[model samples]
Target: MKKINEITEILGDDTSYYLDHVSKKIPKERLQIPGPESVDNFRESDRSPQVLKNLAQLYNHGNLGGTGYINILPIDQGIEHSAAFSFYKNQDYFDPENIVKLAVEAGCNGVASTFGALALHSRKYAHKIPFVVKINHNELLTYPNKYDQISYGTVKEAWNLGATAIGATIYFGSKQSNRQIQEIAEAFEEAHQLGMATILWCYTRNSEFKTDSDDYHSAADLTGQANHIGVTIKADIIKQKLPTNNFGFREVDFAKYDEEMYESLTTDHPIDLCRLQVANCYMGKIGLINSGGGSKGESDYKEAVRTAIINKRAGGSGLIMGRKAFQRPLKEGVDILESVQSVYLNDKITVA
Candidate 1:
């Protein structure tokens, strides 16, 4: 696996852009950043003892294990992005066993996948590594292809399948967001009651979130608010896209926002923009794990390392990367996963 120096070399000239800047707002001190004792420190608090146990299991796995950093392999694309689109290039991934095998071989904290995938091999792999069952997905089969999430299984079913946690997506700002929030909120409560942790794939979907100049779907200010709502529903961890730009609220002129939010709090720096994302995760009490977006070929390793660097410096948790690790041959995919873990393992890559 590569260290920070090797990772920085992969980034080339852009290395200084992420490493040299100091954040202006929400300095890392105020955040309850991840550590080995993260679970013990909050053992007797809002979470049940059983819930804390499972949450700790997540914190203590993978290549980044026991450091309060996590690296998860999420492969629900067979449902969300369609089986053919996700697995056409790599036929090995079509088998659910290969899914679990990849996560284990790649040293992921856990594997998050659909009910069918996990249930098929739960007994064999559940105890070998943590399982994060994704209970909901947006099927593209709808005629007009509406963008909305629906449950594929129940919380009890996931718990029975030996999942340490349950993952779900809420398309915040969508026409059906209200329903999605209510459904996932109740499901999370059930999962917590059953001694399971919960992760929210907090994303924004809506045409209004887009402007000719910028798309607010991945905007820091807007996605930040979406994260606030996710934590409000008591998500133990949040999976979000790395912020692409700021001033989403000001640009859209839809919701209430402060000029200071853009001016005094955040700058154009990637770390600053992502810090706003962490701030909205209940000030890091709820871990903020950024998503590894679609693979762009050739530069996949560099881009994965870059996202990990930005996320770590921003005082966030680790990553839940998928395509970057599974789109190519299994060995190359494992290399990508291990490289991201190396970033968190390097103590020199401190929070900016």
Candidate 2:
């Protein structure tokens, strides 16, 4: 029934309505920092206007673990692996400014990058987005150790760099774990003095600490146990990798398998299982967030989000991902970050 001219207009011109259609569907967001309206209002006030007061309250001036959820950005891979290996393959990622831009664009609560990166990039966006400088780093190219060492950058330096928090990784089961624990304790005290928070990357890694059998690295039971340790040490937030169903505990109490506790703990699926574990861990005071692992296809990323949705539903802080986020093209990586924010804030993973 269409007219010939209409058909010709649709087919011959190559005109497109796709972009316009997509633009209209986008939800209104906190897209621009100090958005246009806020900037206009700011010019009228000297000390503190009502809008600035509201902005401070919304920005979580003093609250980090309340109902106001947290989404952290971690770009520590450059120190975990080698800079050449971690940043060279995707060379644009080597630039510190791009890292900050990606985090802000993705709508994250805060970004966690190494001290060096933050120092280089803070001048531009420190006032715009919150920053967390990772204090310890073990380089693959240097002296090899079983666990990462506390390296450059101090809590004082992070404060100087305008960081909102300081993060460190402590191998829970390593022989040096106690020393790392001591380091964390010291770091916690210092960060608190500066009115900043502390985040810990806790993992059960040595032969002794991991010998618990039921809980160990990558095991829900162990990860949960590590979460408790992080709380005891006063970490404001904690990070762990996704857990597998593999029971690593040494005990063989088969009779207790079908108990209510066990049944309540078990999840409907792997993603749900991890969620259950994090929920179980929430009994402690500290907040728990899962780390984003290696990069994978979009489907795999979505599944990771499905797992995170389970965590958020049951009670989780948010995500602190590295390679899974910044390793790809900047725009695509940001898209993935937005997907995670969608999961955390909206409790839905169906968003593209």
Candidate 3:
């Protein structure tokens, strides 16, 4: 897709409209992010104009609808699981370049990764695809902590390294969630200022809500709330785990979710749930995308694609898939990506 000067186009010389819109839309609390002053002075020098230009390429491929579903292939397994557990068993899965290639070849909206991986491949394949630099991460293999750290190159640095968007994970239920919110807000604001978009991984954890899907209302409400927070903070695309029928909220009635009720929302199998999610996004007035959990079997992966397509048809923004694509052999991964793209963009499906 051709790139347009969206920044200038959106806010023309009549700056009052931009100022008024921003002031009314974003809450003051939402805008309360610590600026560069909070960071040590030593790191400030790198936040240069030249650096931001390079980073904008990572997330913005300038495709899809001007603002469409962002089918992102995220492979941060090395930080989430043991390196060997994630990639060593199949060395083919360890190469970041292979993952990026799969995303591009398969027609993904973009690929998200840590700085090292993006820096290595952006220049060689910059024209081939768009990239998103994951600015914050937490390793599960490490000693457990209340929350994760932003152990990455700065957002400005990531743009300089050639990223179009930036990804940040926030554990909403964590004890340190407030700090994470502040951190992400700062990055989100900065990224937008530089004419780039932001994708937020809004996960819920360390709360009363368990991982079980059968819980019904509680889980749905929890995920919905997390998504709400992301939207409230002005995320362009908010990503969350696929919610189960379970509801984490007591007021929700799980048994009421019958086939007739489901059919009322849309024709897709999970259309009811997807519609509910879309409703939540509509209520919050933002785009919601679901994440592809870890690697799964073929059937499971296909089902995931089916679910994603359902979400899209039900008014979803797109997907943020990871291990499912990257864990496979590179070629197979690329094929899986293409299949997903075909399903998402073209609405072609063979799955039952």
- Model 3 clash number: 26
Candidate 2 lDDT for residue 147: 66
Compose the digit string of candidate 2's lDDT tens values, residues 1-352. Answer: 1232332233243223211111111111211111113223234433234323333332352122223456677887877876788786578777878788777776677778888888987888777787878898765665554565665778899989887777888876667778988988888778766767678887777554344444446766566667777867767667877776534443333222334554555543444445444444434234567887777655545554544554454445567776767777877777666666555444222111
- Note the residue pairs that clash in candidate 1: none
RMSD value for candidate 1: 1.0
Better of 1 and 2 by lDDT: 1
Tens-digit lDDT track of model 1 for 56-81:
89999888889888899999999999
Error (Å) of candidate 1 at residue 114 is: 0.3
Per lDDT, what order, best first?
1, 2, 3
Task: List model 3 lDDT by residue over 75-112, tens digit each.
Answer: 87777665788886467656778767777766676778
Q: Model 3 compared with the native: what TM-score?
A: 0.71
TM-score of each: 0.98, 0.72, 0.71
Q: What is the lDDT of candidate 1?
A: 0.91
Best by lDDT: 1
What lDDT would each prediction earn against the true structure? Answer: 0.91, 0.60, 0.59
